[model samples]
Target: MNRITTAIAVLVLSTAAGCGTSRSATGGAREGNGTVTGIITLADEVGPKTGDFCAGLDVRVTPTGAPEEALGNRTVRVSRGRCSYQIANLPSGGEQLAFTVKPSPAWQCGNGATPTLAPEPQALQLKDYQTETRDFRVSCTAPSAETSTSTSTP
Candidate 1:
């Protein structure tokens, strides 16, 4: 009778331990995920482009204080002027990240034009299981004639 009781106690304790471990693992997996979404537009002085002028552009997100191999760094391509990205299972609590829109070589305003991001690289605070929206606009400016001119020496 004594040996049977001891074995039963051991079995109960092991089952309890297994349950606790599984619960913690499941909670950790679901607690700290986040999503970032946005619309990206390309325009000249006139107005925003109507179609996929901004397609193939890259939107990048990187954690502020983490290494290159950190869990939160993400990048997505602009599709029809929209960017949607999600990061699952980041560290618990929240993280600060930098969002940037990388210009595409195909973008052009005019001859010798320069493209620029309206808000520049942005810093955002993201919380666990939260969704954030950040919109971006790309504008282009033609180089001034004087700056565009190449001086000729006779």
Candidate 2:
């Protein structure tokens, strides 16, 4: 072969070899691999004059259908009304998992009544090692049957 032709062939082969390898979450798996992380935020309420119940809330996560005895151990702090969490080492597939978070309880509303309760026990679904981030809103008002009695003389 001519020297020019040989040089061109070498360059082509070198470039092709480098192009094949790619960096992905699962080391370039067909479905891919990566970590999933998310943050939870709350929207301020303005109706009924209820106090901020979600501020400094505590969130708990537990794997459902695991076992009866293994409940309420893992917890995520949502202080300042925000929380962030992550799920790692996921495989490739359309798999779904359910998790629940118990937000810190609020005490009272503006009318000297019980504070409203937010939504509890949230569910999450994941697919094909998908890295997803989502937010949840709490809407349930605190039950009036329970009220706080804090008396202080001014």
Q: For model 1, how does the per-residue alpha-carbon lDDT over 1-154 read when each residue is reduced to its tens digit?
A: 9999999999999999997877333344433566666766666452334454445566655566543433443555446544444444444356566555677666766545677777876766667677777777777776878786587999
Cα RMSD (Å) per model?
Answer: 7.7, 10.4
lDDT of each: 0.60, 0.46
TM-score, one value per model: 0.56, 0.38
Report the lDDT of model 2 for residue 86: 56
**Steric clashes per prediction:** 0, 8
Clashing pairs in 1: none
**Which lDDT value does model 1 have at 137?**
72
Candidate 2 lDDT over 107-140, as tens digits, reads 2333443333344445554565466654555443
